[model samples]
Target: MIKVYKSDKAPEKLAEAGYTCDEVKQAILNDQKDKCYLCERKVTTDYQVEHIVSRTNNKEKVNEWENLFLACNYCNDRKKHYYDDIPLPNQLEFENVISQTINLKTQKADFRISKINPQLAKLKELLDKLFNGKGICRNLMENRFWNDFMSVYRNFLRRVAAYKIDPTEENKQLVIEELSIEQSALGFKYAFLNKDAELWSEFQDYCKWNK
Candidate 1:
């Protein structure tokens, strides 16, 4: 079960400690640009804010900068309601980290759910059973959820190459201005830095935008 902190009224103190939606949204963009921990998706104009600590179980974590990430719409859709079933205010319901290893040559990814709690492990198992090897539900065979993700990123590099643009420095700033990414550049040491990672390709395109 999980314990969520939402109420009819948000306490005054929550308002002051970077609780407002605006303050937190800025923080989220910076983090997304830093590195997409989930799908390793690049922080683009088309990313969705994801709650690291699911809102259903942790209200304090909800909208919290450290609790959020910039995700493309595709990953969000694949991950929708993943933590919704778990009850609020309990630790067991949350899956902190899900590990996946993608095979570049075969284009197949193997995965596992990781967390300190056994309950979280079970949840990870269920996802792994459903998402491992074959990839997401009915459309599992290299469909929109997977291949499109790779295509977008590959095209991103191609477009940059074709236009003769260097994405390293400028890309970060664009994310900051458009999505409010952080001003600091960590020089790509972060996990999200490498665009070639298997998991990165799996979910990077998930952040596409119509605009």
Candidate 2:
């Protein structure tokens, strides 16, 4: 998952109508670029304004914008307050210490760590399960998740390939746009780059965290 930043000043409607209001949801969708914060998948109708720390564990932070995030239904249900201590994406950028790779043939995600820590480990486990399911529930949903991620990922790769073959200004611009931080399925996009040293060398600068 990529790091996300929320506006310092909460939306005015948040105080008037609370977090469930359309204004608040739109604000979150704007900040998150209409993608799930955990999975980095583009979300439209299935988006949920999720609480990073569950309400059951920390009720006080429920209405706070910093604690709010955008999530797809599957990721939200799957997470379900399991990791109360998992670091916030806004606070800790997962891409800094964690490296994600995928097996093209098998479509299985592999996450590598540059450093070891409890929070990072939990984040890894969370991502592992989200991308690669476990048990009946997750296995049932895994295909949908992978399909959604791969759709964007394949298109991104195609853009890269086109740029590589043509090396024209238009093709290069397309690749650059596809690799924008606001694009969906960025975790997989970045993983693809990290897997190919040559591509990574050419495109690494474009794969930047949102400031």
C-alpha RMSD for every candidate: 10.9, 2.0
What range of 10 consecutive residues in model 2 has the weakest lDDT sum?
132-141
Off by over 4 Å in 2: 136-138, 195-197
Per-residue alpha-carbon lDDT of candidate 2 for residues 74-138, written as tens digits (9 for 90 to 100): 88888878866778878866676678777889778888767878888888888888888975344
Cα distance off (Å), candidate 2, residue 17: 2.7
The digit string of per-residue lDDT tens for model 1 on 12-124 reads 44457644455455554443343343344465655666665556666767645434555555545555555543222222212113344445576554444454655455445
Model 1, C-alpha of 98: deviation from truth (Å) = 6.9
Give the top-scoring candidate (TM-score): 2
True-structure lDDT of candidate 1: 0.41
Instruction: Quote each prediction's TM-score.
Output: 0.43, 0.90
Error of 2 at 210 (Å): 1.2
Supply every candidate's count of residue pairs whose N, Cα or C atoms clash at under 3 angstroms. Answer: 14, 0
